[model samples]
Target: MFQASKVAIVGLAFGAFLAPAFAAPAQEAVDRTFERIAAGVSRAGLEPVVDIDHARLAAEAGVEMPPSRVQLFSDAAVNSALLAQDLSTGLDLPFRALTYAGADAVQVSYTSADFLKRRYGLDDTEALAAFDAALAPALDGLDGVEPVPVPTEGLADGYGILTLQSAHDVPETVARLRAIVNAQSDTVWFGEVDFTAEAAALGVDLPPAVLLLFGGPAPGGVAMAKFPSIGVDAFCQKLFVHAAPEGGSVVLFNSIVALAELHYGTSAPPHAMLDERLTATFAKALE
Candidate 1:
């Protein structure tokens, strides 16, 4: 696990010192790289799964904000193979790229498959290696982009994670999560994706895994307002329900506070409360 507080803070401080030297060229490269990445992914036969233009959205809403965007793209076949290796990898799919105008330069970045393999403790080499290879075309020529370093063992420690033993099966747990979100006045059901079904269609064996995304305007808007970059982590919290190796179902979610800290280098009161509410909602759904 990456040390969220220390490493991230220190890295920023160090980066600040070098910001002046890299300013102009970095920003120009970032703009060019974003266009290159979009074209590259399409050329690679991957479709854009999600595209959030943070700058445009803020502008339309009459808010002045720094430029930023988050785009996710992936090929169905490639993703199926990755899911077969470890269902948890679904959280990082369908391949996200984050671009933002930094103090010195516009920056473009994404989590690497190698980094994720280590973070998730995935051991399916053939699948992961293939997944990594598939990403090359999209990332190939980015001048300054690099994946964040990942720890070698266990799950990524920086995330706030909650694992619950479910009394129901995977499908039922998913249904319960959806119903719970629907029942909440402050939350709205965003969507759900089934990695298990996708992998099974490819003749790749995988335990049932479903990702449930949900959150509403108020909490989401607040977090994004506090730190626009928080859109990468807090826009919609995801609850994953999957078959445990031991024969039961398990439910898990990334902690909003931890994600905020990881991405923004600080914590917010609203995010903490939102995390508690989401944790409670999942606990109740499982019960």
Candidate 2:
């Protein structure tokens, strides 16, 4: 398990913008996404890392930058060593924006187990199991959302997950997450979900949102200083069950690099936007 974690980190760099593919999102749309993601994050209660230049954030979101501002963006991208230092300190996942390119809205993420536990004081593994207890009622309130079979794949370190997504409101999904997270206040607010082009392209028009769901349940209470390869069951609980607004089915993989490559063709893990990690090329897929 530990060795697997090592391998994931070892291949950190991905080649720069190989495809020049595009997803054009309006600036207002990008702002709304930032607000939604930030609010969801705030509710989760994880501490923020240092802020990068918001202006650069705008640039990543596809804004035109002045010549002076170009340096700002480049400097922000290159000077992202703070996060690498954080990761080296044993923090498994960091919650923050990676790059908010127009239609290509992306952020740094972790499993529900790690992200939620660290945000709130819910560290005990039982805290995760508590969601199972809450699932029945919370899900009942979810209109248009349907539950389907969960897919499980046997992996050396953890089991892979497959499940049909529910069609639910973005805020409602956040509410459901709050029910599971259980650390949120009585009233919680989520930002407007910005749907990704990929989700839309698939006929799944889920609200654009980031839900760091557990495929199953996390082991709980492990120190961030230790990079423990989460067990198979643990990974299952961390699997994201993204509810497509209409018919969009988004599969949340354990590795974001896979999602980035699969969804946007970016060879590098979105983490590259966070630090000086090595960039990786896509492994050729064989049918």
Candidate 3:
């Protein structure tokens, strides 16, 4: 099993620091590299779930930000194994890679394997290995370069996931959530994923589950400006609604407090109000 080095863990405790660079013109490199990654995911037999254009989102919301994009792809086997261990793991499912223009070179970032294990208590080595291997193709020819480290500690159990009981079944709950989100002003509805359907495609059985993604770039941009890599935190907020074995639907999302601690190394990171705004939007949707 892979363990997070002491250095990596400590880096998360402190603030951001320099990491090895991927030399290229910032804007062009980010878009081109992300495109290559998206193509690689398709070539690897994974379903390309969604490609989020963060820079464009920021621009539309009247917030200036550098070029940034994220590609979310699905690996059925890996998804099944991880979610089997903990349904909340769905929050990070359909694995994503974020590429953004940084100070000197374009930087690529993703959820850390070690952080995933700790946050969800994941121990499926086979699945974890498979997940790690999927990103290898994107690293070709980038010798001695490392992705930006984004290790975070959640404020509570299950990464401080906020769960709500839904009065309806999976489909209805999803529809209601969608309607609520669409009603919000300045919020961009990114996309949604039917995990149950995706797993079924691979001949696996799972209870009804769906993930809804959306963002309010005006607030999201402010949060990201303070902590660039925090986009994974909630800029593209993930709302996971899954059927509970006990017979009702449940909705899940990360708490801003937990994400703040995770990404900014503090529960009270700068621009917290923006995080609050983003969280409230989801809270209203789930309600």
Candidate 4:
């Protein structure tokens, strides 16, 4: 496991390097262009799951900024097979796209599926490549769009990542995760996607795999109170269960501390407690 401090440094450095790509889009053109992009994403079959209105939230907090928004979209119907290959991919899902008015030009951006597939060490390159290609239509009519670059190696070296070998198969691992969440208070079950089944229906072969999305209101409320924008990364945690290439099943999730630091630029008291709870939960489930 990567140390929290090390992960923080790496994550910060990467964030800084990518800062330019996230520059706000041009002022006059951003609104219209944003709508077009949003329409395109919908047309591509990616359903909008979360919409974070940074500008409005900042205004409510007495801070001012150009029009900006972040949206997460997902097409579980199509991408389940790809997601099943690597559960860590859930961290990037539903696919996030940001649009903002820059000093010079309005900008729209999203990380490419190819970058994510490689970053997360997911299998089936051909499938991901094709999926990436399929996303072009969404951006076809957009201007000043940027696709964030992800390094080929050390992709997740900056995040607190935990991977465990599961004694049970994929279905059982998912059931265990569900049971664990069900037993907890204030935790919201965000539903599960069985990518293996979704893929099989599409006439593709994907190893047994499932994704569990769950989290509680308390930690999320705390994080959002400190930084509303961080709500994009807060309140939700995911567990991915899939067959390991080496054999057997594996489960994975990002650490709360890492996520807090990455999103808020600082770790909070709640993070430590959340981390402990998550560690214990995973321990019990995997054991």
Each model's backbone clash number: 1, 26, 0, 7
Residue lDDT tens for model 3, 1-287: 01112221121222222122323255557767776776777667777666666655665566756666776777777787777777778888867778777776777778755666777777877777777786556444433335764565443347767777876788888888888877888676777877777778778788888888776667666666555666655677788899977776888876666666676576545455754665576566656
What 10-residue stretch in candidate 4 is worst by lDDT?
Answer: 1-10
After TM-score superposition, the amount by which residue 140's alpha carbon in candidate 1 deviates from its true location, in angstroms, is 5.0
lDDT of 4 by residue, 59-171 (tens): 33344445555555666643764565654565465565666564455556565765565556666877577667666666676755653322233345325666778878777
* Candidates by lDDT, descending order: 3, 1, 4, 2
lDDT of each: 0.62, 0.26, 0.67, 0.57
Among these predictions, the greatest TM-score belongs to 3
Q: What is the C-alpha RMSD of each candidate to the true structure, in Å?
A: 9.1, 21.5, 8.9, 10.0
Task: Rate residue 131 of model 2 by lDDT.
Answer: 29
By TM-score rank, best first, the candidates go: 3, 1, 4, 2
TM per candidate comes to: 0.71, 0.25, 0.81, 0.61
Candidate 3, which segments miss by more than 4 Å at Cα? 1-25, 142-145, 152-157, 267-271, 278-287
Off by over 4 Å in 1: 1-36, 53-67, 140-159, 184-188, 246-248
- Write down the lDDT that model 2 would get: 0.26
Please provide, for model 2 over 42-149, each residue's C-alpha lDDT reduced to its tens digit, 9 standing for 90 to 100.
Answer: 444333322222222223334322100000001111112211222111122222232223223332222333333333334345534442332222222223223221
After the best TM-score superposition of candidate 4, give how far the Cα of residue 59 lies from its true spot, in angstroms: 18
Top lDDT prediction, candidate number: 3
For residue 209, model 1's alpha carbon misses the true position, in angstroms, by 1.1
